[model samples]
Target: MKHIKFSISLLLLLVFASCEKELDLQPQQSIGIDAATATPENINGILLAAYDIGRNTSPDNLAPLYNGNYSGYLNISSELLGNTDQVSWNGTFDYLRDIFNKALINNNTGALNIYSDSYAIMGHVNTVLANLDKFDDAAERDRVEGEAKFLRGIVYFDMVRFFGQQYNPAGNNSQLGVPIILTPPDVSIRIERNTVEEVYTQVISDLTDAFAKLPDDNGARADKYAAQAILARVYLQQGNYTGARDAADNILQNSGHSLTATFAEAFDTDDNPSETIYSWVITQQEGTNISNTHYATEALGGRGGDIAITQAYLDKFDSDADQRRNFTYPGEGVSTGLLLTSKHVRQFANATPVRIAEMHLIRAECNFRLNSSVGLAPLDEINALRARSSAPALGALTLDLILNERELELAFEGFTLHDYKRTQRNIGTLSWDDNKLVFPIPQSARDRNPLLEQNPGYN
Candidate 1:
């Protein structure tokens, strides 16, 4: 149960230094840049540092902000936005209110943190990519490179979804996207935003290359199938159903992964079920539990109910017989009348980033979209997941039915907003094309980098 500690002090020192010639290292903190590339172990440590940053979900850290909370896994209070009757949020935090209201300013702390944190991780990855030649073994070099790129690709994918307009195929994906920092930026260079298409192209290229270079077995780290699984998600987000289905199918058939026997098993604290493709492993000594953000009540070891499930969302589960329904309970503390979920309960539970069940759903939805051309019958795929939950299966599939299934099955895992936007589905009173759907580029970033332009309507 002892956690492995990976230090990034040296890497951060090197990465944040204003000038290359000013890269001075404290004797006890980290190795010099020359010493880092001098050995395979040193370079490998930097790769581990990237993983450490990726795993950070610390509520206090400005960098690598919590994706789940921001993505609507937990409902926080909002003062700027009128109170919603469905879920109670303790909106004392101004930054969270900015997110809830979709009224993000360029200087909002949460927005700035995500933007800064993503690039911080990317900088580390780029450093690893830059020094791949220094790795003594060719295969080791490829493995490291693949893992780093996989991390980079997912980071870019997340950043683009948050900061840019939804990819519109009709418009040729011409909307402004996040600035792509491929190699670490020079101190004097301010990067400009890439078009949405350009960012996607790089994301796909990174993941595709990662899929090729990664080993079949990477344990908790990313592997070949993890790259493919994420690529499926990217394809789905872009409305490329065929590509999504094929990528997902590859994982379902070839990877030795399968759905856990029951719906509850997927979120079990004792072990990571076979369903997980890639996860952020947590231990007693390291990483805070996500439950702290979602569950209310001191009994549940959560803060005063920062987020609660809306009755509207809860009503999506039409069948009380569905085993997944057991995850919910009457809310307490600040969420006294609402409902909360036990999906993330234990302080040491692992956070699943991708799982096989999602792959099947992706395949099913894609097959449905494509009229059942490439993969299994869409009904069968739907039934497979339904069967796990003991929910009755439907004979035919419809877009609404599929989305409802997604809402129930993937609730609180940070998919709702993206799912609604990508499918052009309206959420509550907001239309798909509403300017508020896309966040403004944080003002701090624009102030620091002149080439960075804000998203429309936020100025």
Candidate 2:
């Protein structure tokens, strides 16, 4: 499951979305930059290309290679790695099976792509930042910088969480995080894993800057609230309840985003629903949707059903009346008896990175924990989401109940493993902080960079 290194391959990351050209980077810079990176259009092209981070050219549909960082892997990988009894990875892809079994080695292709892609995105955004002065308009310049920072902050936050030990707010958190690479590195530069605290601080810095510079309306790219949304999640992960609550409040109150009319209306189409805060749109010509490729059955245009829902996941629902529970279909062929998710059934649906519903959940949990209602009462927030599915509401609530509600609402949208670790809950028999849950630094990376140290337990 080894892969060719992505360090060079990701250098040519700027192309028109309509063209959908394959990314092929060599040792030299492929895109020309004349007279301080030439025109503003060139800068914009580079920025747009940052979202399409497909690396794998593999022909296998079962292991579709459209590896955009914002794709289904972000959520699916988290679901598999921290799986308790909720879902089963019955797929033939060995790399994914390893993640499900918690038996991953450094050479695992899935793990390597995730690790390498995070770094490659950082590198891509760095290029964008370096050429920001190319734009003559001051307002456009600030917006471009904000978007680049947003891209870097989002991937860096994901990298630190997946690659470093879970952050403990009360502790100093001196643990090794992935390197904080602000500038693109050449062959001569050595790298080191910054501390968990350093990475988290950098993420906050980048997002905070993005929040200030980004506009209220910028089409589909990261806007002001988008930065705030990621900041809220970052604050929650770091146990800053007050900060988390405040950020979520900003999104819920002023983002002008709202919930879908029904649970079934939330997905499948491009993330154009009012609920989506940030998304990466995938036209059929742009790239294939990895979620659909893996989550759907052959009849629906996916490979043999790979990811399936389990009875345990169904039991979490309050009743059959809950509409989200109805999003089920019998599995394909050999796995016909199993159940698969209906959330991902289209090949070109947008990969939603953040949703308005996520902010609501964060606000509810933070409010309950602090015993202070910042936006809506905790119970009201929880019930608001439940009402979408016509699920029965409860008269009282506990932290566990709120957390459970969060799980049910965010199913297949990512945030499972992060939530489990943050709440100090175990994945079945495994401890919440099990080393197996953290991805090993890809061996290929270490072979190239001597200064980059590995996470413990993969050796």
Candidate 3:
């Protein structure tokens, strides 16, 4: 006979409180913490929380920087297409700043607060890791740790890129990057900053550990390849061409993942295709604006009113053969000659991967940088994709061609601005000032931690 369970645990209260949010989007303090004190189930809940960060937000979800809104802001295609006419501060800039300010700093940190919520998530994961030895099931325990590490590394990767400079492995040690908060920081332990190198080292360490501990096919919850894919990106940013290539090679060899055959089908408006390795499944929530859901739609249609796609990106596509041209939707308005972004025209409710496909492009770019000969293979890779789209194949590959291909292929996928930085290309004569190149360290963060210094060129 099953016994009736009747016990009150503070852990349950803590977990419940941790998940609940106030209107301000911060967590309501938990009343009891005893249940979570040393329990494996509670440990898993914390890991789950970490996975939730970066899933929803205005910048990724509704900024002109990556999605359809490139029309108004010159900063976008400026470096990509060598056009510098449209870079201006609109809602996208304010949205990104507000998001960083609210989630990273505001007291009511929760699922909405990407930064502080991430710290809370890290807390949960670290707690589980500290108590891993106590779990009865080894596989279960190991999986939990792996997920935690994956989430930690992912957040750190984003932090360094958005708040600090891109990882220059050579300069990371002295460069001001985000604080390397491994475990929870107390008043005393709260850090000022780590060199971009130090932060990257920790990112790689966590991802490496995750790679070893994570399962091969665990479905969306952080597996080995996902960690490897992210690590490949980290390596690419650090200009470790060999490291990036090897990491990409490891995935190509060990994982069954492959690029989608056709450009149109690859980025088709349906939900995420087979190519997605990992994605924050954008679940439908009440009050979540469909237009504000994807970067493409928001960038294209939002109040930002950035410049529309120019003839340059359009010219890259073989107009007659490529179906993506339809997605660009020309003649919608006086300013919007290209009415809609083809990659994402549907409602945002459809579940999709936040990181995929473009990674292959990133891998190819890393290879290209390491050895220009390797560029041929990546060019072939993209051409293979173009051929599937029924577009005419190019005669030969060049850096400019590859760069343009990346812009055409990964447009509005959040890499347009950052990629410009990575390639060290100028955004033409009319676009960004020195201030737009790097984000300021933010006055709020500076006030809290006096040790923090603003990024040069921003002040």
Candidate 4:
């Protein structure tokens, strides 16, 4: 994997040069601020660049590392960590080992990559937002602005959740979060962290505006429902059950999206299933490295068996009836007897960002929390997802039951860690308030900007 050089000064120039080449225009040796913001085509290219960063992966920059491996989406076997019971990677990468162990350091490469890549993408989005007047057509300008805000909202949400403590609505969320860079900063600027409350305020503000301005029909791009879905998630994280329930209800009532008839059909890589609200488009010509990370072995056409499923996690499935369990294959990689997830078996499998099933779960949880049978009973919502998989429906619902369903239904799509942290649930031996659960700001970043403070518990 190749890492792209990223910095505020360089990003401006690269955005212009890349857009010029993408539009088949002569490569400009120099780009002025005015020229970069003057054309619709130029702004569109910048937006595309923002989307492009979501797939970035490398030892130093692993934006794609979020949901799958680190969140226990797949079980990993590595000799570097000293576990020899299962098949493991023979290579010695301290960063990978540290992340898997839930013992991250300030200098970890994977954490640095996520921080850098997220902010880099945010920089592009900020550039677009700052130049909304550049577009002559009002509708085009609104659409672009909406999409930029949606991206910004999600990136900030991702960063805050990782760098700060979990949101505590009752406590006012005063814990420090990542710096909020709404507009691109000057080359000399240094930033301090915002409170978690402040970050969520901005996320909700951006997404609220995005939901209003975004068109309903932007295929594969940020659409209205995507913003709504994310807004619901943000509310849920904050423990605003009513807000989450309302936002999710809005999507269910208005958004045409629905679940696929079968669990297997929902994951088809060839097309965006009806369940998908938004997905990172992966085409044959250009695909993701997820297959290599999670499924790669001689049997799976990957370089090595980088990740496998733990028997403990697999046991969560009902062996007698759950159809989703079929997606797992007995591992043939380094973990020869373990189970490997086949969800992203192909290199070109599209990455689902938000799906309709999540909306159902959010609504279910929110309703359960409020103890009001507002839209749908929590039991019905849980049953809806279970019925699709042929799992036995529960006669009653509890917070524990809903969370268990979430663990099984939403596993590997990146919500596990956040769910645990926000709900104050423990994962294995790690508690919700554990310092290890929140990643330290990379040492490289702190060294560059004197004002940047390290997260507590890291030197």
Candidate 5:
């Protein structure tokens, strides 16, 4: 695929690891200046940066995007290269750092604004919560406070995942993750990484409060159901099976969300379908280099192809019944077998987070992991998805199959690598080597923080 040139389009191509965290260029000025005194409109403008970063973190450009897409392509190749789908310089990881690195080097304080942006909103929440008297009406204060909390929760949640380990209840405190920057950290705060569990605990706490603060549904923004779904994902990663199962079940039962009948329509971009629980809006940029749908086409376009799905990933849904097969079409001039990702095909529209279907799948996995005796729940969930593929449901469900299916079903949505980490699946391996399982903690992080430690086996 042709490499898309970095231009003004690329400047607006803000990349986020998730809705929760971001990489900010060092600020020219401290975030400590009291933004609390700003008018509500200015505060809202500050908050928009968080949302902007969240929207730009397209699944196509995330690290796993390269991993899943290119690896999937290589798996189909008969050559079986030792270098299959690996992100060795010419991959998703490289593109991901482009925006942040540029911003860092140029000292673009605009990027640094995300830190203050998030807390500035949080400050609004605090202001409202602490001084309901300022708002004249209790309902207005409560609603505004809830919106602030939801934004805060989403931002923190994203950061924790990118900068820290997956939440492992058994060893949470021992896990070094992102430093908790709840309030704008003071210049002398000298941040330290918190335990993964602590980060997750705070996320859960923030979301839990958000659920109470939010209504049942909030149109395009996050609502009670979105918070619940996020909480369920956090629980699953933490090995809190019951919590995951319950949170998921609550959404399925109470939130009026449901899966679209066919897999093809599920991800269509022309209109925002009902299944998206929460998402950030993206304005279509014609020349933007990072369109996820263009993944398959980009490489063949001649600029430069960073990653394309391997044949193995395509083969996962080779069954005639799988409707997802039709959704994936070959990019122009591409070889026959490589399938381009069809998950986000909009010429331009907002990205949607999974609504009901994802939560249902989470419940099934949680129950399956808990070894539920009913068995029917997992079967039912699998069948629901299988029905979309037009494939028959397989025999008994196992964590392995569910894990594999989740990858197949949600390949480019940015969960693959993290899921691999959380489940402790062997990463960095073509075969069954354990050494490739965890990422080397950026050596730079260790050099900066003496208390930081690397994942086992990396050294």
Candidate 6:
């Protein structure tokens, strides 16, 4: 039943993603920001389509062979870039290898895909926001609008992290970030990059509005708690420990979500465990888990094996105690000793973007940092997940214990690069804020929009 809502059918929507402001004509796919051209049905389609676009799960995307921006590399690009040889990128895609090696050029296809695809999702949300008035009922309109903002905020949050400099809490983060485009592309579309601080301010604003306007349960779609969950993440990212703890406390105290019966049970999106605060759905009929294709081997219903596990990762935890390691296995027929992860290997496995498990960690870390226990004691919160996995409980808690717990729990779930940057952990020789750690602005974007500027290292 977990698949009932989003499994309806795949949508073929032309989501426009462009940087050109001075255009001879309005783009053909432009959803003119006018309700006269949009109906209730059309608005609904656009909103639903935005979800698919984020995951790039549906067919008929700009490119069909590989995963589109978010779905394919949502986890890969980030993890690979911060991998530090801990995980192997055996995939044939050179663009990904470029990202991992930090040898990215301005036109690196990997960076371009993520940059453009994120904005494409923004285009969908902008279109939806423009047509909320199409619904006659005021409350319904608010719900639809909240959902749009939820998705738009999500895209912006991701875009700024991948393309712009990391958010700074102590000083003014005036560094250039991605453009904050709120309107759908029409006759005029020139926009400049917003500061990292500005982009985050907008993200928080949008998500705060989403939290206020979104309903408690919108099927498998984003609900009120989903917005709050992302807000908790946003605060955690910005090092607002108080806000992160309070926000996480709100969900933990009232959201009725908890860890699954076991650690592994939380991963099966098909079960739709309450632990999953938000997830990107994948169905054979609706679309595929291309993210899985890159991570799993051919035997586990993925491509020949783009990503494999290294023995180094195994050494991170007590292999005998940590149940999470049990999922790793050697490649079916390869003598090269390549190992695959079952997390994304299973056909049509859903991508988990946020979950209650993360919330427990956030609350724990924030409480530890703030010296206040809002929901549970720091050790209690930490042990909740550890105890679930049967991992040995710590006699006490420290910052390193909390961080290692996060690493153990969120490993290979797309937290690598951002976690490193946030915690100021160096990726080997590269400092946490190294220029190479940042992705360059795609040259194609600069070609179309002269106003945009590149990041530090690309110079």
Candidate 1 Cα outliers beyond 4 Å, as residue runs: 1-32, 57-87, 268-270
- Cα error of candidate 6 at position 6, Å: 5.1
Candidate 6: tens digits of C-alpha lDDT, residues 1-459: 145434212222433433331221234454444532257877777777667666665444344422455565767878888887678877678888888887888878877777766766676678778767789988888899899999888878888888877789896899988888888655457678899999999999999999999988777688889999989989999999999999999998888887888877777465467788877776666556666777776766676667787877877785467787676667765414787776776667666557788899999999999899787999988877888888877779989879888877888888889988999999878988888878888887787777788887686
TM-scores for all predictions: 0.88, 0.91, 0.74, 0.86, 0.71, 0.92
Q: Judged by TM-score relative to the true structure, which candidate is superior, 2 or 3?
A: 2
User: lDDT score of model 5?
Assistant: 0.51
Candidate 6 global Cα RMSD: 2.9
Candidate 2: how large is its RMSD? 5.4
In order of TM-score, best first, we have 6, 2, 1, 4, 3, 5
Model 6 lDDT-worst window of ten: 17-26
Clashes of 6: 0
Comparison by lDDT, 1 against 4, better one: 1
**What is the per-residue lDDT of model 3 for residues 1-459, given as tens digits with 9 covering 90 to 100?**
011111212333235223322111222455334445457766665555444332332222322111212111222322223333322212234444333232222221111233344455455555557767667998998788888788788767766765565554455257677767665323345356787778888999999999999999876566888899889878877778788777777776567766666655555332455566664444333112222332233444333223345555566665566655444654233334334455544443322343445555666666666654332377776676566556678777667877776776666555665566566666554232233444455554455567766666534
For model 2, where is the 10-residue window of minimal lDDT? 15-24
List candidate 4 segments past 4 Å from native.
1-29, 57-92, 296-303, 333-335
lDDT of 1 by residue, 1-459 (tens): 122443444444443322211111122335455765566786677677666655553322334322432222221211112223334555366776666666667666665656665776676687789888887788998999999999899888888887787888665888899878777535555778999999999999999999999998887678999899989999999999989999999999889889988887887354457888877666554454554544545566666566666666667787889987667777665667757766755556765447788898899899988887465788888988998999988888898898878867876676766887888876558786677766668776676677888888877
Predicted model with the maximum lDDT:
2
What's the lDDT for residue 386 in model 5?
75
Q: Give a tens-digit lDDT track for model 4, residues 133-246.
A: 778899998899999999999878878887888898797678899888877534555778888889999999999999999999786687888898999999999889999999
Candidate 3 Cα outliers beyond 4 Å, as residue runs: 1-34, 57-120, 169-173, 185-188, 267-271, 285-308, 315-320, 330-338, 349-356, 372-376, 428-435, 457-459
Give lDDT: candidate 5, residue 407: 65
The true-versus-predicted C-alpha distance at residue 383 of model 1, in Å, is 1.1
Residue 312 local lDDT, model 2: 92
**C-alpha displacement of 124 in model 5, angstroms?**
9.4
Regions of model 2 farther than 4 Å from truth: 1-26, 29-36, 54-66
Lowest summed lDDT across 10 adjacent residues in model 5 is found at 65-74
Candidate 2 TM-score, true structure as reference: 0.91
